[model samples]
Target: MNRAVAHPQQDGQDRPGPTTRLSVNIGEATAQVLQKHKARGISITETVRRACAVYDLIESEAAKGSKIQIVDRDGTTRELLLIP
Candidate 1:
Protein backbone atom coordinates (compact mmCIF):
# COMPACT_ATOMS: atom_id res chain seq x y z
CA MET A 1 0.00 0.00 0.00
CA ASN A 2 1.07 3.55 -0.74
CA ARG A 3 0.85 6.19 1.94
CA ALA A 4 1.64 9.87 2.35
CA VAL A 5 1.89 12.00 5.47
CA ALA A 6 0.54 15.53 5.12
CA HIS A 7 0.70 18.54 7.36
CA PRO A 8 -2.37 20.73 7.49
CA GLN A 9 -1.72 24.29 6.43
CA GLN A 10 -3.76 27.46 6.86
CA ASP A 11 -3.03 31.10 6.12
CA GLY A 12 0.53 30.27 5.06
CA GLN A 13 1.18 28.51 8.35
CA ASP A 14 1.45 24.78 9.13
CA ARG A 15 -0.93 23.30 11.67
CA PRO A 16 0.02 21.10 14.61
CA GLY A 17 -0.87 17.57 13.50
CA PRO A 18 -0.14 15.39 10.53
CA THR A 19 -2.86 13.95 8.32
CA THR A 20 -2.90 11.00 5.96
CA ARG A 21 -3.14 11.49 2.24
CA LEU A 22 -5.27 8.79 0.63
CA SER A 23 -5.41 7.74 -3.00
CA VAL A 24 -8.42 5.80 -4.22
CA ASN A 25 -9.54 4.30 -7.53
CA ILE A 26 -13.28 4.69 -8.02
CA GLY A 27 -15.66 3.38 -10.68
CA GLU A 28 -17.32 5.53 -13.37
CA ALA A 29 -20.68 5.58 -11.59
CA THR A 30 -19.07 6.82 -8.39
CA ALA A 31 -17.22 9.48 -10.34
CA GLN A 32 -20.51 10.70 -11.86
CA VAL A 33 -22.08 10.98 -8.44
CA LEU A 34 -19.10 13.01 -7.19
CA GLN A 35 -19.44 15.27 -10.21
CA LYS A 36 -23.07 15.93 -9.39
CA HIS A 37 -22.11 16.86 -5.86
CA LYS A 38 -19.40 19.13 -7.22
CA ALA A 39 -21.98 20.93 -9.37
CA ARG A 40 -24.01 21.52 -6.20
CA GLY A 41 -21.02 23.38 -4.67
CA ILE A 42 -19.92 20.53 -2.44
CA SER A 43 -16.31 19.53 -2.36
CA ILE A 44 -15.29 15.90 -2.64
CA THR A 45 -13.61 16.03 0.77
CA GLU A 46 -16.75 17.38 2.45
CA THR A 47 -18.91 14.78 0.75
CA VAL A 48 -16.69 11.94 1.90
CA ARG A 49 -16.61 13.33 5.45
CA ARG A 50 -20.39 13.51 5.60
CA ALA A 51 -20.81 10.05 4.13
CA CYS A 52 -18.40 8.60 6.68
CA ALA A 53 -20.25 10.21 9.56
CA VAL A 54 -23.57 8.78 8.34
CA TYR A 55 -22.14 5.31 7.81
CA ASP A 56 -20.62 5.38 11.27
CA LEU A 57 -23.96 6.28 12.81
CA ILE A 58 -25.75 3.47 10.96
CA GLU A 59 -23.20 0.89 11.97
CA SER A 60 -23.29 1.98 15.59
CA GLU A 61 -27.08 1.76 15.70
CA ALA A 62 -27.13 -1.59 13.92
CA ALA A 63 -24.76 -3.01 16.50
CA LYS A 64 -27.32 -2.15 19.18
CA GLY A 65 -30.01 -4.31 17.50
CA SER A 66 -31.77 -1.31 15.99
CA LYS A 67 -33.65 -1.45 12.72
CA ILE A 68 -33.21 1.27 10.14
CA GLN A 69 -36.35 2.28 8.27
CA ILE A 70 -37.63 4.84 5.86
CA VAL A 71 -41.08 6.39 5.91
CA ASP A 72 -42.74 7.64 2.77
CA ARG A 73 -45.06 10.62 2.40
CA ASP A 74 -47.99 8.24 1.84
CA GLY A 75 -47.59 6.71 5.32
CA THR A 76 -45.68 3.73 3.92
CA THR A 77 -42.73 2.42 5.86
CA ARG A 78 -39.90 0.14 4.70
CA GLU A 79 -37.04 -1.44 6.59
CA LEU A 80 -33.49 -1.07 5.37
CA LEU A 81 -31.25 -4.07 5.85
CA LEU A 82 -27.49 -4.15 5.95
CA ILE A 83 -25.62 -7.42 5.70
CA PRO A 84 -22.32 -7.79 7.42
Candidate 2:
Protein backbone atom coordinates (compact mmCIF):
# COMPACT_ATOMS: atom_id res chain seq x y z
CA MET A 1 0.00 0.00 0.00
CA ASN A 2 2.87 2.33 0.72
CA ARG A 3 6.48 2.40 -0.47
CA ALA A 4 9.30 4.87 -1.00
CA VAL A 5 10.51 5.28 -4.58
CA ALA A 6 12.51 7.70 -6.64
CA HIS A 7 11.04 9.84 -9.36
CA PRO A 8 11.12 8.35 -12.85
CA GLN A 9 13.63 9.66 -15.36
CA GLN A 10 11.08 9.54 -18.20
CA ASP A 11 9.03 12.10 -16.26
CA GLY A 12 11.24 14.94 -17.56
CA GLN A 13 14.23 14.31 -15.31
CA ASP A 14 17.03 15.54 -17.54
CA ARG A 15 19.56 15.48 -14.72
CA PRO A 16 19.67 13.37 -11.59
CA GLY A 17 18.71 15.97 -9.05
CA PRO A 18 17.92 15.44 -5.41
CA THR A 19 16.11 12.17 -4.94
CA THR A 20 12.90 12.89 -3.08
CA ARG A 21 10.71 10.09 -1.92
CA LEU A 22 6.97 10.12 -1.43
CA SER A 23 4.88 7.33 0.01
CA VAL A 24 1.12 6.97 -0.44
CA ASN A 25 -1.45 4.43 0.60
CA ILE A 26 -4.32 3.92 -1.83
CA GLY A 27 -7.08 1.64 -0.63
CA GLU A 28 -9.55 -0.18 -2.89
CA ALA A 29 -12.17 2.59 -2.83
CA THR A 30 -9.57 5.32 -3.17
CA ALA A 31 -7.99 3.43 -6.04
CA GLN A 32 -11.39 3.39 -7.75
CA VAL A 33 -11.58 7.15 -7.43
CA LEU A 34 -8.05 7.45 -8.84
CA GLN A 35 -9.11 5.28 -11.75
CA LYS A 36 -12.05 7.59 -12.38
CA HIS A 37 -9.70 10.53 -12.48
CA LYS A 38 -7.46 8.62 -14.89
CA ALA A 39 -10.52 8.01 -17.06
CA ARG A 40 -10.73 11.79 -17.36
CA GLY A 41 -7.09 11.80 -18.64
CA ILE A 42 -5.53 12.85 -15.35
CA SER A 43 -2.39 11.21 -14.00
CA ILE A 44 -2.58 9.30 -10.73
CA THR A 45 0.07 11.47 -9.12
CA GLU A 46 -1.66 14.68 -10.14
CA THR A 47 -5.01 13.43 -8.89
CA VAL A 48 -3.63 12.42 -5.50
CA ARG A 49 -1.64 15.62 -5.11
CA ARG A 50 -4.66 17.73 -5.96
CA ALA A 51 -6.75 15.83 -3.47
CA CYS A 52 -4.09 16.35 -0.79
CA ALA A 53 -3.96 20.08 -1.57
CA VAL A 54 -7.73 20.34 -1.21
CA TYR A 55 -7.57 18.49 2.09
CA ASP A 56 -4.88 20.86 3.30
CA LEU A 57 -7.11 23.82 2.42
CA ILE A 58 -10.04 22.31 4.26
CA GLU A 59 -7.85 21.58 7.31
CA SER A 60 -6.58 25.13 7.31
CA GLU A 61 -10.12 26.48 7.19
CA ALA A 62 -11.29 24.09 9.88
CA ALA A 63 -8.48 25.22 12.17
CA LYS A 64 -9.90 28.72 11.78
CA GLY A 65 -13.32 27.56 13.07
CA SER A 66 -14.77 26.79 9.68
CA LYS A 67 -17.11 23.92 8.90
CA ILE A 68 -17.12 21.91 5.72
CA GLN A 69 -20.42 22.66 3.97
CA ILE A 70 -21.81 19.85 1.90
CA VAL A 71 -24.84 20.13 -0.37
CA ASP A 72 -26.45 16.86 -1.30
CA ARG A 73 -28.16 15.98 -4.58
CA ASP A 74 -31.54 16.46 -2.84
CA GLY A 75 -30.52 20.01 -1.84
CA THR A 76 -29.93 18.97 1.74
CA THR A 77 -27.04 20.66 3.50
CA ARG A 78 -24.61 19.16 5.99
CA GLU A 79 -21.73 20.62 7.91
CA LEU A 80 -18.64 18.73 9.05
CA LEU A 81 -16.22 19.97 11.65
CA LEU A 82 -12.85 18.21 11.74
CA ILE A 83 -10.99 18.31 15.02
CA PRO A 84 -7.31 17.69 15.21
Candidate 3:
Protein backbone atom coordinates (compact mmCIF):
# COMPACT_ATOMS: atom_id res chain seq x y z
CA MET A 1 0.00 0.00 0.00
CA ASN A 2 1.05 3.59 -0.66
CA ARG A 3 -0.02 6.85 0.97
CA ALA A 4 0.86 10.50 0.55
CA VAL A 5 0.19 13.46 2.83
CA ALA A 6 0.68 17.11 1.92
CA HIS A 7 2.20 19.39 4.56
CA PRO A 8 1.75 23.13 4.64
CA GLN A 9 4.40 25.66 5.51
CA GLN A 10 4.75 26.33 9.23
CA ASP A 11 7.48 28.93 9.71
CA GLY A 12 5.85 31.52 7.42
CA GLN A 13 8.73 31.32 5.02
CA ASP A 14 8.32 31.80 1.30
CA ARG A 15 9.25 28.57 -0.46
CA PRO A 16 8.79 26.75 -3.72
CA GLY A 17 5.96 24.38 -2.96
CA PRO A 18 4.31 22.16 -0.43
CA THR A 19 6.01 18.99 0.80
CA THR A 20 4.41 15.61 0.48
CA ARG A 21 5.11 12.76 2.86
CA LEU A 22 5.01 9.29 1.40
CA SER A 23 4.51 5.91 2.99
CA VAL A 24 5.08 2.58 1.31
CA ASN A 25 4.98 -1.10 2.08
CA ILE A 26 7.85 -3.35 1.08
CA GLY A 27 8.74 -7.04 1.20
CA GLU A 28 11.22 -8.63 3.58
CA ALA A 29 14.11 -8.44 1.11
CA THR A 30 13.57 -4.72 0.60
CA ALA A 31 13.23 -4.22 4.36
CA GLN A 32 16.57 -5.95 4.85
CA VAL A 33 18.15 -3.64 2.31
CA LEU A 34 16.73 -0.64 4.17
CA GLN A 35 18.16 -2.02 7.39
CA LYS A 36 21.59 -2.26 5.77
CA HIS A 37 21.34 1.32 4.66
CA LYS A 38 20.25 2.35 8.14
CA ALA A 39 23.29 0.57 9.58
CA ARG A 40 25.38 2.73 7.26
CA GLY A 41 23.76 5.85 8.80
CA ILE A 42 21.53 6.53 5.82
CA SER A 43 17.91 7.30 6.49
CA ILE A 44 15.22 5.39 4.62
CA THR A 45 13.88 8.59 3.05
CA GLU A 46 17.29 9.51 1.65
CA THR A 47 17.75 6.02 0.25
CA VAL A 48 14.39 6.10 -1.51
CA ARG A 49 15.02 9.60 -2.87
CA ARG A 50 18.43 8.61 -4.24
CA ALA A 51 17.02 5.44 -5.72
CA CYS A 52 14.33 7.42 -7.51
CA ALA A 53 16.88 9.84 -8.95
CA VAL A 54 19.09 6.97 -10.17
CA TYR A 55 16.16 5.13 -11.67
CA ASP A 56 15.08 8.27 -13.49
CA LEU A 57 18.57 8.75 -14.94
CA ILE A 58 18.80 5.11 -16.02
CA GLU A 59 15.40 5.21 -17.63
CA SER A 60 16.24 8.41 -19.48
CA GLU A 61 19.54 7.05 -20.73
CA ALA A 62 18.06 3.70 -21.72
CA ALA A 63 15.40 5.51 -23.72
CA LYS A 64 18.26 7.13 -25.66
CA GLY A 65 19.73 3.70 -26.49
CA SER A 66 22.50 4.08 -23.94
CA LYS A 67 24.05 1.01 -22.33
CA ILE A 68 25.00 0.94 -18.65
CA GLN A 69 28.26 -0.79 -17.71
CA ILE A 70 30.41 -1.65 -14.74
CA VAL A 71 34.23 -1.63 -14.80
CA ASP A 72 36.17 -3.79 -12.39
CA ARG A 73 39.56 -3.17 -10.80
CA ASP A 74 41.09 -5.66 -13.29
CA GLY A 75 39.91 -3.42 -16.20
CA THR A 76 37.10 -5.80 -17.02
CA THR A 77 33.86 -4.27 -18.28
CA ARG A 78 30.36 -5.72 -18.22
CA GLU A 79 27.00 -4.37 -19.35
CA LEU A 80 24.27 -3.84 -16.78
CA LEU A 81 20.70 -4.34 -17.90
CA LEU A 82 18.17 -2.88 -15.50
CA ILE A 83 15.41 -2.19 -17.96
CA PRO A 84 13.80 -4.88 -20.16
Question: lDDT (CA) for every model shown?
Answer: 0.69, 0.69, 0.70
Residue lDDT tens for model 2, 10-37: 4533256864557878689989999999
* Model 2 misplacement above 4 A: 1-19
| Candidate 3 accuracy as TM-score | 0.73
Cα lDDT tens digits, model 3, 1-84, are: 232223333343225677568788899999999989989987776677667756776677778887777679998999978747
lDDT: the better of candidates 1 and 3:
3
Per-residue CA lDDT of model 1 for 1-84, tens digit only, reads: 332222333232233576566689999999998889989987777666566656776787779898777779998999978889
**Order the candidates by TM-score, highest first — what do you get?**
1, 3, 2
Candidates 2 and 3 compared by lDDT, better number: 3
Clash pairs (backbone) in predicted model 1: none
Best by lDDT: 3
Candidate 3 Cα outliers beyond 4 Å, as residue runs? 1-15
